[model samples]
Target: MWAARLAAPCLLLAAATAPLDARAAEESEAQPPAAEAPAWSGSLAAYLNLPRGNEAYVTGIAIANRGALHLEARSNYEGMDAYSFFVGYNLGVGEAVRLDFTPILGFVTGSTHSVVGGFEATLTGRYADAYIEFEYVPDAQPSGYAYAWSELAFRPVDWFRIGLAAQRTRVHDNGRNLQRGVFAQVKGKHVSGAVYWFNPASHEQVTVISVAISF
Candidate 1:
């Protein structure tokens, strides 16, 4: 009789809380979805191009991203007095060895006018990163040409990186088709500066200093 009386209150307690637990479960299932990401973000990079025994030039690049949409503009990039604009979509995958890829189509105006199509990719890791971009000007003169730029870099500190850089560009008609060199960069919270010296041993060596800001 004593055991039966004690178990009677325990059974009543569980029976009374059962409706409360069911109500809590139903409320959780009706919760809203996650919030969206920011609407817009962008970065601006300006490079000062200085060549030995040649006139210096300024090249500026602007990139704007809205979610997966990517837009870019280049001033004095392909050649002196030239301009280019691109539109593309960004795709990415992985975490430990992440890769971001964007395939672009654009038009080149001003000095060199053509239809350009290309792709840009970057692979990132804990201490190493690699970036490459390739573009083909199908409508350029004299049967057209392809342009490429790449960097293989390693970070020694949180804010500094040393890298090997290579490019095949016709920005300057100096007969230096493939210029390879080394670069060093220092990064801050929202800004970065890089110095690249291409063909350090040749007479037509080029030095490119670039500054970039993100917002």
Candidate 2:
């Protein structure tokens, strides 16, 4: 009789805990996994203008997770005409599209002393990139102006990309000008470089080369 009573209580205890153990396991399985942490990255770039005989340098840093927040600064060593700082955010629309919005503030050396506001938007995908930008300045030389640029590129190998690029600029007094050209880019693990050559229908030719390093 004593052994029978001991076995009965042991069976009762196991039966009571079995449901609790199963419920815990089910909850664990249903819970989602933790998200990965964000990463920080930065890049430095230099651009050389062949026609203008000027050089511009730019540096930027960003933190990326679901989206990226970045700050960039640019300066022209030959002159201060293109000195500016930009703050921007990059948001992923879906698997292949990313959008960026940035605000620009800069001075036009020997021209407007006041800081002006400018806006830039960029859309990028696997094979193409496009951007529209404009700046507001009361005393700008070309008057109110804006520009749009687009490029479609294909990667034939791991490190080389070839593309066709087009650019349009609209100025108040100068009218609209369009330029089209071909571009090539080569990329390495930590460095990349690109070159562009465009000729306006009735204007001077423009050439630009840029190199960038990432860390």
Candidate 3:
């Protein structure tokens, strides 16, 4: 009878202690470390280019986290001069997928009109010292047509970059057209300048030159 009593108390103690130990282990397993957030960056750029027959100039500014705001004034001496504003958001930084929106105002020789708005999506990839970006713009009226553009940029040295880009546009009613262009750029620590040839259409082209300083 005494031995039976001792065994019963010992079994009860083990059962209670097992549950407490399991609860402690489960508490430890539930806790984990927290994650960190990403940082933001800003940039300003100026450009000059000649697309088929006109001279164009632009000054662009960007203030962004993962998202960006772009504002620019574009002028073509032989054609229309436009002021453009846009918003661009990076879906993933240093990765594929980006989104853009642009609204434009254009004025020329004797007429004025709203250039409408445009939206775009882009994907990017890199290989060795060269990187390529693919962009798709959807169909929009008055100022935009559906288009795809591909660009490749190469870094000859740390602060100098050169690139070439090709674009094709499909109009809702007119027809299909193509543009081919080349660009050369030099970027310092806080400022950058670019020279380019922009052939926006098969028969229309512009040439432009510009300079910008940033803080």
Candidate 4:
């Protein structure tokens, strides 16, 4: 009788704990794994543009972390003929999209100085990526100017991408110009490279090549 009584309690305790064990197993299977923390990242790039009559080179650097402040700078190689500095906040819209709003201060060494504001938004997915940017500068280049650029790219693999880009700029008294181009880019663990061919409606075509390093 004593053995039966002890067995009865043991069975009750087992019955009481079985549901909890089952629930814990179910919860474990249903819950997603924790995500790893993001780290700081940055890149530096050099660009060469070849036109019919003139060749120009530009160097740029940018640094940012996840959901943090971003800093960027760009200048031409010819005595920093054209230079720009940007300060911005980076925001992630979703898992695959990010937006940066920045204020830019720029100068052309002996020509003009201006203040501008801009935004760049990028969408990255498994097979493709797209980017758009807009900038407005008051009293720039002897007059006010606005610029917009958009690109859509497809990535066939992890490293290579091909894209089409369109860019437009409007300048006071200088008229508006539109350029369309195709670009190919390759990215590795720490190195990236791209080439672009741009054709303007009323001007000669231009070719640009760029290489970058990331840290």
Report the C-alpha lDDT of model 1 over 88-175, residue by residue, as the tens digit: 9999999999999999999999978998999999999999999998889876666688888899999978799998999888875678
lDDT of 2 at 161: 78
Candidate 3: where are CA atoms >4 Å away? 1-40, 51-61, 66-88, 93-144, 147-150, 167-177, 198-205, 210-215
Best prediction by lDDT: 1
What's the best-to-worst order under lDDT? 1, 4, 2, 3
Q: Considering summed lDDT, which 10 consecutive residues are worst modelled in model 1?
A: 137-146
Clash number by candidate, in order: 0, 0, 19, 0
Better of 3 and 4 by lDDT: 4
Clashing pairs in 4: none
Off by over 4 Å in 2: 1-15, 34-38, 52-70, 77-82, 91-144, 147-149, 166-180, 200-205
Model 2 Cα lDDT, one tens digit per residue, 152-205: 677777688787876663311123366677789999998999997766343455
lDDT for model 4, on a 0 to 1 scale? 0.68
TM-score of each: 0.85, 0.59, 0.44, 0.67
- Winner on TM-score (2 vs 4): 4
Please report, in order, the local distance difference test score of every candidate based on alpha carbons: 0.91, 0.60, 0.47, 0.68
lDDT of 4 by residue, 1-215 (tens): 99999999999999999999999999999999998776778888886766444455454545554546676665652123656666777766556554434434333332436665777778788788888877666756456766676889999998999999876642111232666789999999999999987774445566678899898
Ranking by TM-score: 1, 4, 2, 3
